[model samples]
Target chain A: MIDVQNITKRYGHHTAIDQVTFSVAKGEVLAFLGPNGAGKTTTMRILTCFMPATEGSARVAGFDCTEQPLEVKRQIGYLPETPPVYQELTVTEYLTFVGRLRGITGPKLSSALDQSIGRLELGSVRHRLIGNLSRGYRQRVGLAQALLHDPPVLILDEPTVGLDPKQIIEIRELIRSLAGSHSVILSTHILPEATAVCQRVVIINKGHIVAEDTPEQLSARLRQSEKVSITLKTCPPDCEMKLRAIPGILNVLPGQAGGSFLIECELGRDLRDEIARVAVLSQWGLLELRTVSMTLEDVFLRLTRHEDHLSEPAEATVSASAERTDA
Target chain B: MTPVQAVIAKELRGYFVSPIVYVVGAVFLLIFGLLSYLYVGFAGAQAIQLMQMQGGMAQINLNDLVFRNLFASMRIVLVIILPILTMRLFAEERKLRTFEFLMTSPIRITDIVVGKFVSVFLIYLGLVALTTLVPTVLMLFSDFDWNPIWTGYLGMVLLGALFLSVGVFASALTENQIVAAFVSFGMLLTIWLIAGLGNLFGDTTAGRIISYFSYMEHYDRLLRGLIDTSDLVYFGSGLALMLFLTHRVVESTRWK
Candidate 1:
C-alpha cells in the first residue's frame, strides 16, 4: 500500500535523508527501528504528504504524495510525534473536528468516533478537556485521533513514547490486533517494541538502512556466541563460580526464572552436555535447559555500531518469525 | 459541512472558548461607548446653542458633528483592536504544531485562509454590531437621520475586515502572536500614514493615486453615505490581495 523509491530530502548543505527507499505491504506492520535523528520522522513526513522530498517520489495508497497530496492525505491516518491535539477542546470535540476535516459526517462520523474512542479506551475522558488529562491519556487521545478515520494506511511516529508499562503493553496489543486489515509503519527507538508487535524490523542509522530482516533472522545472523539457559531444583553456593571456571565459557548471568542460570559460551562449543554433567555429578536436578537466541537489542547494537556497520543499505522486504526480548 | 466551513466553525468556536475574544470585545465596546458619549455631548451642546440663538429652531447637522468624526475615530480603534482578534489565528496553529495536521489534511490552503478570515470577520462584525446599541439608545431620546450612521457602520465593517485580513497575513508570517500583532499594527499604520504622504503631494495625479491607495479616501466616501463603486472595488481588492498573500505564505510551508 506504500512505496518510497530513492527519496532524498536535503536542507541547504545538510541532507536529512539520503537516497532512502522502503515499502510497506498491505496488512503488514513494519517497524522502522532507529535511534534518534536516524531520519525516521523525516521519512514519515514525506510519506504522509506533509512535505515533499528534494528528489524522488513517495506514493501512499497508489496516490503520489506530491502530485495528488489531497488523495494521499485522504487515505492516511497520521499520528505525529506530538499528537497534534488542541488542549482546550474535549476529546469528542477534537475527534469530531478531525472527523469533519476528513469528510466524515453525521452518522458515519459519530460511529467512527465511538469506535476510536472505544478502541483507545477514551470513553471515560471523552467529555473532559484534553489539557486536564495526563500525559498517557493525552497520548491515547492522539492515537485515537489517528484511528478515527479508519484509513487503510497508518503512520505512527513514536506511538508509545510516553505511556506507562501497562499502557505500553495495551498499545502494543492494540497494534498487534491491527495486523490483518491495516498497513502500519510505526517508527520507534525501542528494540523490544519492534520484536513484540512487528513482524519485520528495518534498522536505520545516520540516514542509512543498516539491516532489514525478520527479527529472528537479524538476531540469528548477528548471533556470535552461544547462550544456554538452565533451571535447577536446588542451587549450590559455588554454582556460578564453577560455571565460570568451565573452559570456553564466555560469561555467566542470572536467568529470569527462580534458581535459574544463563550460561554464555563460545559459538561452536556444546555446552549442554557439560552443563548436564555438572548438574548430575553435583546432585542438582536439572529442571529445564535450552539454548537462548540473541535478542533484537544485540542486533540493534551490532548494526548501529559504525566500526563494522553495513556501508551498502540492506535491500528488499522482510517477513516471518517473532521473538521476545529478555533483556 | 464542507472543509472550509468546518474550519470556520472550528475556529469560531475556538475564539469564544478562549479569553482573547472576551477581552478584545470588552475593550472594543468600552472604547466605542466612551467615544460616542463624548461626541454626543459635544453635538448636543452645539445643537442647543444653535436652537437658542435662532429663536428655538436651527439646523445643526448631526451627520457632520457626531457620526462622521465618530467613525473616523472608531476606525483607528478598529485598526488597533482587529489585529488582536486575528493575531492568534495562524500564529497559534504554527506555534502548537497543528499546522502540520492542517497541511497534511485533504484541504486546500485557501480553505484555511478564508475560513480563518471569515471567522474573525464574524466576531468583528458582532463587535461592530454591539456598538449600534450606542446609536439605538440615542434614538430613544431624539430623532436624527439614520442614513449616514448606517453607512458609517458599513464603513466600519469594511475597515475592520481590511485590518483583519492584514492581521491574518501577518499571523502567517510568524509563529509568535505578539509579533504578529505588532507586525500587522505596523503595516496598518504604514497604510494609514500613506494618506498623509498623499497630502504632501497636494492635487497632483501621483498624489491622487497614492492617496487612493490608502483606506482613508475610500472609507470617507462611505462615511458621507456615498456608496461609490470605486470605493467598494478598493475595499474588495484590498481584502482579496491580503488574503491571497496569506494563501501564498501558507502554501510556501510545504517547500520549507
Candidate 2:
C-alpha cells in the first residue's frame, strides 16, 4: 500500500534522511526503528505528503506523493509527533473539523466521529476542551483524529511516546488490531514496542536503513555467539581454564554472583553439556546451566554499532554472516 | 462542506471562544464612543455659536463635519487594532504546530489562506458594523447628506479588507504573534507615510506614482464621496496582492 523509493530529505547542507527506501504491503504492520534524529519522522512526513522529499519519490496507494499529493493524502491517516491538535477545540469539534477536511459530511461524518471516539476510548472526554485534558487523553484524541477518515494507510510517528505503561499497552493493542485491514507504518525508538506490535522491523540509523527483518530473525542473526550461564556450589581453582579448554568455546567470564561463570562459544555449538561434565569431574557442584538468547534490544544495539563501524574492513565478515542469516 | 468553508467556520468558532475577540471588540467600541461624543459635542457647540450670530438655527453638515473626521480617525484606529485581530491567524498555527495538520490535509493552500482572510474580515466587519450605531444616533439628531456617510463606510470596509490582508501576510512570515503585529503595523504605517512623500515630489510623475500607492489617498477620495473606479481598483488589487503573497509564503513553508 506504500512504496518509498530512495527518498532523501535535506535542509540546506544537512541531510535528514539519505537514500532511504522501504515498502509496506496491504495489512502489514512495519515498525520504523530508530533512535532520536534517525530520520524516522522525516520519512513519515514525506510519505504523508506533509513535505516533498528533496530527491527520489514516494507513492501511497499507487499515487505519487509529490505529483498527486491530494490522492496520497486521501489514502493516509497521519498522526504527527506532536499530535496536531487545537488546544481550544473540544474533542468532538476537532474530529469534526478533520472529518470535514477529508470531505466527510452529514451522517457519515457523525458516524465516523462516533466510531473513532469509541475506538480510541475518547467518548468520556468528547465534550471537554483538548487543552484541559491530560496527556494520555490528548494522545488518544490525536489517534482518533487519524482514524476518523478510515484511510487504508496509517502513518503514525511515535504513537506511544507519552502514554503511561497501561496506556501504552492499550495503544499497542489498538495498533495490533489494525493489522490485516490497514497498512501501518509506525516509527518508534522503543525496541520492545516494535517487537510486540510490528510484523516487520526496519532499523534505521543516521538516515540509513541498517537492518530489516522480522524481530525474531533479527535477534537470531545478531546472536552469532552463544552465551551459557553456569552457577556452582563451589568454584574450583582451575574452573576457568577447564571451561576455556573445551572445543569451540571462545571465552569465559565471571557471572554476577560468586561461584557463577558465563561461557561463550561459536554458533551451533552446545557447551552446556561439556561444562556440566567438566564440573562433575572436578567435584564442583553444578547449581544452574542454561543458554542465553539475545533480546531485541541487544540486536538493535548490535546493528547500530555495526553501522557505526563501517570504516573497519575486517568486520565485513560479521556483516556477511548477518546477510547469510537472513536466508 | 468545502475545505475553505470548514476552515472559516472553525476559525470563527475559535475567535468567539477566546476572550481576545470580546476584549478587542469592547476596546474598539469604547474608542468609537469617545470619538463620537467629542465630535457631537464640538458640532453642537459650533451650531450654538452659529445660531447666536445668525439669530436662527444654523445649518450644520453632520456628514461633512463629523462623520468624515470620525472615519479619518477610524482609519487610524483600524490600523492599530486590525493587526491584533489577524496576528493569531497564521502565527498561532505555526507556534502550536497545527500547520502540519493543515498542510498534510487534502485541502489546497488557497483554501487555507482565503478562509483565514475571510474569517478575520468578518470579525472586522462586525466591529465596523457596531460603529454604525454612532452614525445612526447622529442621524436622529440632525439632517445630513447620507451619500457621504455611506461612502465613508464603504471606504472603511475596503481599507479594512486591505489592512487585514497585510496583517495576514505579516502573520504568515513569522511564528511570533507580537512580531507579526509589529510587522503589519510597520507596513501599514509606511504606506500611510507614502502620501507625505507625495507632497515633496509635488505634481511630478514620481509624485503621482507615490501618491497612487498611498492607501490614504484612495481612502480619502472615497471618504469625500468621490466613488472613482481607480480607488476601488487600488483597494481591490492591494487586497488581492497581499492575499496572494500570503498564499505563496504558506506554500513555500511546505517546501522548507
Best by lDDT: 2
Instruction: Assess each prediction's global lDDT (C-alpha) against the native.
Output: 0.87, 0.89
Task: Write model 1 residue lDDT over B1-256, tens digit each, in one string.
Answer: 7888899888988999899999999999899889888998998898888888887767777778888888999878988888899999999998988888898888889988999999999999888888889888878877779998898998889888899999999999999999999999999999999999999999999999999999999999999998899988999999999999999999888788
Q: Quote each prediction's TM-score.
A: 0.90, 0.95
Candidate 2 Cα misplacement greater than 4 A, ranges: A280-285, A308-327
Clashes in model 1: which pairs?
A: none
Single out the weakest 10-residue window by summed lDDT for candidate 2 chain A.
A318-327
| 10 residues in a row with least lDDT, candidate 2 chain B | B135-144
Question: What TM-score does chain A of each model score against the native chain A?
Answer: 0.82, 0.90
lDDT of 2 by residue, A157-258 (tens): 999988999989999999999999999999998888999999999999889999889999987776657778778899978889988999999877776578
For candidate 2, what is the total of clashing residue pairs? Answer: 0
Candidate achieving the largest DockQ: 2
Mind giving the per-residue lDDT tens digits that candidate 2 earns over B1-256?
A: 9889999999999999998899999999999899889888898899999999998879988886788888899988999998999999999999998999999999999999999999999998998898889878877877788898899999999999999999999999999999999999999999999999996899999999999999988999999999999999999999999999999999898799
